[model samples]
Target: MCLNLPQMQSRLLLISPGQSYRLAPYLKAAERLGVSLTIVSDSRYSLTREVADGIQGDFTEPSALLDAIIAQAQTTPFSGVVASDDSTVELAARIATRLGLPTNSIASATLSHRKDLARRQLQAAGLPVPEHWQLDLAREIAPQLQGLPYPVVLKPVSLSASRGVIRANDPDEAAQACRTIARIIAPLSNPIERQTLLIECYLPGQEVALEGLLQQGVFTPLALFDKPDPLTGPYFEETYYITPSRLPDAIQQRIRQTVADACRIYGLHQGPVHAELRIDGNQVWILEIASRTIGGECSRSLDAVLARPLEEYVLAAAMGNPLPVERRSGASGVLMIPIPRAGVLRRINGVQEIRTLPHITDIRISMESGQVVETLPEASSYLGFIYSTADTPQAAEQALRNAHRALDITIDPLLNS
Candidate 1:
């Protein structure tokens, strides 16, 4: 979408690490538009390669991060500000609000980032949210868990990518899960405290991920990704995301409607909205929603529809420009390479063999040898991402499975173990 804004120097300020899995496509989009971008990040992006100026800082400190962004803006104002992940979304909202840019309200951003707040708001809106409780680390969680049903999900209030999200089948399991989550979040410093967590009755149904944009509190559905692997989990490590949904059109529309209502309830009036929803018969339960696109390499599934990258749409929307929405015509999918165990990555073999799969488009191993890799309930990073597109959603999904089967990842025990 192109906007009819007054002609002036346009530069976007992105709040994300350069190495972020979500940055490359957006960088490509900005490059195509010749839009200069400045980044506020903790690390450098290889994709930028000195092309984009970067400011180093702790993104977790919202106030300090906003101050840095404000200081930079005084010298060279930004046309828009955007976040690269769940951690930065709040900061981006603050920056956009401070700059008087078009974006969702800070309150909305807060609700979107914090699971506890999101559940409260949705419940108040009369939306279907699982029965849950907000437990403060300062108190005894066991007493609070007395009446709540088992097979509940215990999660960090603001963590993303399923980090610290654990499903407990009983009281004993719930207690252990809480302790495990506390340990996982202990070292992180953020506005939301590690002591705060949400435990909700686990909803049973097939899960689907919705990626779209919200304009004036209305939702424009872009893609709906079907999670082929059942997420019925002790731990949810997302794998395949196949789009051009296999769900019936009626069911898909219902999903969109539910999500649109959710955006309104959350007060998300603009920018990208990535939502996870579950379906069981006629019931549609929203698991969670983010005021951003789908995270990780999963987002690549929706890129370059109608010759425009997904980031292009996001940028246009941020500037309040009217870029026409276009989605890729056929089926597309991405397999987020899940970490199999907690160990030091030793080597990755058989990339050449994986590439031999007919539908494989790209194979990227994100983690390097020597780096420690851990799976869900403690980790956010994926081992890598595999991309595939086919004439049908089933074929694309199968290709991802086939390609994954061909790779051999070697992880050695920790040095001290």
Candidate 2:
């Protein structure tokens, strides 16, 4: 099964390559464009030999990862370097630059990542956001802060997926929250593992995401994802998304413009960007942006929903190729992993109903029997995903829900209240 490299097109370097379970759609899209992707493992890669170029290693140590990418580029002549995960985006930028490739500036890349850095940079750019206070793990405690805002959000600047996010509604909750925060920090496999925590005023509003590309500082805005839940709590786990964002057309324009501005403010030059925002009516606050594609099943959802392959666009954009202007892209939807309590999956029923439903592409389940599921700190547990498309967003929504409702999921309780 030796495939000739000479016939291959784009040689893509995927840093931090892990579960491509979410990368299937992108891989399919790349194939459509005749792009040959090579995954350069960023850490203990579990996928196997066929996953990528097999540059197996970690990206936390920038120099090591940079050297590896350079080595691969020498042979592969990579048209693009993609950091498939949030943690390794910095490494991706360095790799692209070392090869005289297109990517965000190193400083901007780091700032666009790491929530704390992003906040500072955005604030400097005069964007509105939640008020915050940086912490000192050793500090005894601030004495004059008794009158501050309650329901504060304790979040790590580096990690996504609400990894180290906690909420404190009051001083007592804040104290307990502090202990949980300590636990969150102690398990750092690396120094960069959630090292910084910011206790900030929790903004009450709807949370949403903007997924698109920033090329040479010009923004080619794409989809706006609406997470239709109060994602504000202990661990803000995202559960669902709908395209043609529920936000009004005008408001959506503002969000795109704001995101583009944020990218420029952060000095993003190229590559896909995923940004989170909190909006209450017309007033929108910037949450954070990552210099990479939207995580979770989003890339798949977007590809299936839009009828346009995002990975191809990502590859084209990454390589300084032009992508289409944002226009009447079709509709698609996805519901992210949600909390279903702590349990072991027993059986899933009603899947037959999902199959019969129209406008549905796929229903995916990530966990299996005998596997432990935790839903606390917000409904962060995702049982799986349901992808659908339609002539209109409404039709897509109906078909997916019809499929979802027909299914019966039974799980063995692991931790019952």
Candidate 3:
């Protein structure tokens, strides 16, 4: 559905990492909305034809990035600013705030981006969050790990997509996990993120993801996804996400309410919200909340139910003309194809076979053959994404599983390993 915005000539500035998978979809959405879009990233994009107005600025340096955006605004002012991913959301918020555009405050974005800060804010607000501890990486981790709860999950403060997240069963494991996480986050340029790690008591339950939009501090849930695959992990690498969730209606409402409360606590008043939570019996535990649409190609799953691409809503919200949140009947899902091992990909077999399966919509193999792939705690990208749709959530989830089973991924062990 093409959204007929009042500002038909509006230009949206999309801030994202150069390698983000979200850029193409958002660009397509912008075109569908009949709006001009500019690309802003730290690296150059090959889509020079689609993105005529591109700005390359280091995301690590906010002062320089903001200056560049302000300079660009003088010539071609953006009607709205949107962040395509978690890494760029805070900066997007900062840009929006600077330009006096509709956006959540920078503090809200920061709280959402930093796990440690989010936990503190949520706890202070009396929200159900796992007991967590922040460890100063500059000091000895072993001393910090002492007397902490066992079976805790340790992760870097700001890395998303479960990168550098590990579950430790005991003190020894916690110490080793911290060391491993340190190495995983070593390449990050942010001093605070590089120097701090969060260890939180692992909450065991069925996990779910909420995709919603916020307007004037009110959150409207777009989709509630059931993570059929158990996230009880030594490392939390998410796989399956099926929606309209199979959970009871009342429980689902509580999950939504929890997310809304979290948004209120963070003072998030506008744009898309992607929240992850754990349902432990009757208790709803907020795992993490991000001020962005659901990550990766997973957003495509919503098209089956929304009757339009999720990016349309996101773009509409960014442009300060949020379309009504509505869902048509049916269920959909996406499998974030997980990398099985650390190695160079040799070949992926059975794409044809998977496509033949019932309800299988698409199979995207993102990692090219011969490209090196890493598993969780260090892995950043998925092998690819598998999308499906059916009359029921079960059928949708089964379709994803069936598709995954049909494929045989072969990875050649790294020479060093």
Tens digit of per-residue lDDT, candidate 3, span 184-293 = 98888888999899999999999999999888788899999999888888999899999999999999999999999999999998888999999999999998899988
Q: Write the residue-wise lDDT of candidate 2 on 299-402 in tens digits.
A: 77777544466777787776566667544556788866464566777877776678668888888887786777776443334788888887777777777667
TM-score of each: 0.93, 0.88, 0.96
Clashing pairs in 3: none
RMSD of 3: 3.6
lDDT of 1 by residue, 169-272 (tens): 98888888888988987886863557898999898888999988877776888888899899888988788888878888899999999999999988899888
Error of 3 at 200 (Å): 0.7
Number of clashes recorded per candidate:
3, 8, 0
> Which numbered prediction scores highest in lDDT against the true structure?
3
Cα error, residue 30 of model 1, in Å, equals 0.7
Determine which window of 10 residues in candidate 1 has minimal summed lDDT: 1-10
Residue 356, model 2, lDDT: 64
- What's the true lDDT of residue 338 in model 2? 63
For model 3, state the Cα shift of residue 43 in Å.
1.0
Error of 2 at 287 (Å): 1.0
Kindly state the number of residue pairs that clash in model 2.
Answer: 8
- Rank by TM-score, descending? 3, 1, 2
**lDDT of each model, Cα atoms only?**
0.82, 0.72, 0.87
